[model samples]
Target: MDLKIFSTLPILLLLYLLDCGSAQSPPPRGCESSLESVYFNLCDLNAVWGVVLEAIAAVGIVITLILIVVLLCIIPFIQDKRKKASVAIQWIFLNSTLGIFGLTFAFIIKFDQRTCPTRLFLWGVLFSISFSCLLAHAWRLQRLVRTGEGPSTCKMIGLVLVLTLVQVIIAVEYLVLTTVRLNNVCSYENKDFVMLLIYVMFLMALTFILSTFTFCGHYRKWKKHGAHIFVTMFFSIAIWVVWIVMFVRGNAELNKSPDWDDPTLSIALVANGWVFILFYILPELRHITCPAKKEDDPPENIASSQRNPGLKGVDNQVFFLEESNRGIALNFEDNLHSPSYRGPSPMGRNVYSSPQEFTIPRPHTRPSYHPTPLLQDPYLNYHNRQTTF
Candidate 1:
């Protein structure tokens, strides 16, 4: 027992010395509680900007998912062929908006070699895609307002892709220039980033200018679409201006510019994503997918117009220019059954309006049927032919 006690004392004393040694050593940086801690950076409670941007990103993602689902649901019920064709452009535009929201998280995270390349590439590319979609839509609206005909679905999508491709090329070129040739993947200044985005800025400017023409065209009905685009571009331009100012010159004045960069970008991305959804996507869907109320329709007739498409109300108006021949659909036969669909029959005397007037009932047809037994008499000659009158 005495020998065992002596041996155990030495082992216990050695363990005590080891613990003291560990206690005297220095601890790691104050990053143990955050995800960025692993990278030796601040996050969560350690960084206010990071926390705020993270929360905004989460909300933006949820809203984006909801908008996507709503847009998908609305696609099938669009009866206008031209409007249905426009759905493809809306899809690309929405996808770009979602990418904008998702990329905000990348900005919120700590910048490093792995993320720097992606940030540089996607920042310009995604913005370009969004702006390009707006530009293509502006072009389509311009054409529709002028000639009452918009281009085909393939053409609109192709235009957006072509415009976006230029920015993709620019992004690739600039990324290689900074990350490879300069060997400064994570060391580029805000000015370098801003300079690379010049092409995207031009797209924004072009879209804004083109949207103004929506009111210049003869078709006043389509002015609403133009107004939606104009408002979206207006707010987007403001966001860009404020961010670009802060990202380039405003931060430098404050001395700790690097700390403000992520916040600026993250806020811009989130605000713009919401703007696109609230201003353009929702209103565009409401107008293009649902029937607009005509001011001329009586309260009683409103329900009837919705129940039947053949009724010659605003729903039956030649509002959408059919893409088949880029002209109005000539089937006025659908309007023949509506009792109140009558208008001054200029075509009764003019041959040019013959197709529209031919369906109007002859002046004497209604008078012949009510008082006379001709409608009920089975032996009446050619009764089947006379009933059609």
Candidate 2:
């Protein structure tokens, strides 16, 4: 009986192999009978997450373009050399962020050998570019706060590119090792993906820590920059935590590990890109592009932006108005309530409660006809001359 069963096992296995080979699975939803079935992961608008992410990334791309235009347009108007020096970093930062959004399209499409490696390689590159630019910016802020200046535009740009180069090398090595060496292009595990991003996480952590150092300096005006960086890094850290957990453990626990991988990464990309746009990039663009006020500006002819003698009195002067007609010197430093100053005149509202209007006294007049004895009215002088005659 055992020999007979063994002989029939070979035939049964062949039949099962043929049956399994003949059993064809249905195409992906919203993909059947479509001309774009080749790349239906993106073209399949019926896939809710793919459609939503595509729309979001499209919007982000448009907004980034508009901001780039605005940044370029405002560059000519930016008078401060420090701010002007920052333009290159800002441009690099914004374009990297745009790449982040644009790269989302790769993830939205179906995963193939080519798409997989492209996604893996570009993911760290774009993120590294953005974080390195941010690192340079935050470093500049700290330096500016401490020394009241920053490095030249060339030096800052070089620093950013150098920092980003490290990640590029790492990403290239990772891509080659995983795709070419191992011959596992699209089959790379989730852990492998996270491992490839370790350098990027290090950059992010460094950027987050460095951003806080802006407060250590004396200049508090730029402390708002620290706050902005802090918040952006904070939320980014949180988003990373959630996605890493889902990608590493939660998806497997829920029995959706392989299926959820694309959505997990796609969602993280979209969320973090928006965070960059909303938290860091928009605020930075607004700051660098704002119209300069006269008080904050140095004279046009002066070669040095530091020789701001005009700002010296801004802290001390409570009310200041410069008109060439009549010099009404209202020195309120002596007394807040000068006796001559009753109240503010009804012409306009006064900032201070008591107005310091200097009252000039009228010279004494002898009579309506003459004031000085020698220089009396012309008629009186003529009469006196007639008397003399």
* TM-score per model over all chains: 0.67, 0.68
Best by TM-score: 2
lDDT of 2 by residue, 1-389 (tens): 99999999999999999887666444566666534444666656567888788889999999999988998888888866777888888899889989989888888876876688788889999989888888888888888767667778888899988988998898888777766767886677788889889988998999999998988865555677667788889998999999999999999999997789889999999899899888987887777756555554333433243566666576333232222112222322222254543343442233334344443322234556342223322122322433443
Model 2 C-alpha lDDT versus the unseen true structure:
0.75
lDDT of 2 at 348: 20
Q: Which ranges in model 2 have alpha carbons more than 4 Å from their true place? A: 1-38, 291-389
* Model 1 C-alpha lDDT per residue in residues 310-383, reported as the tens digit of each score: 76754433332122112112223333344644443442344235545433221233444553212332212323
Instruction: List CA RMSD, all candidates.
Output: 16.6, 14.5
* lDDT, candidate 1, at 343: 41
RMSD of 2: 14.5
List pairs with backbone clashes in candidate 1.
Answer: none
Ten contiguous residues with the weakest lDDT in model 1: 321-330
The Cα error of candidate 1 at residue 210, in Å, is 0.3
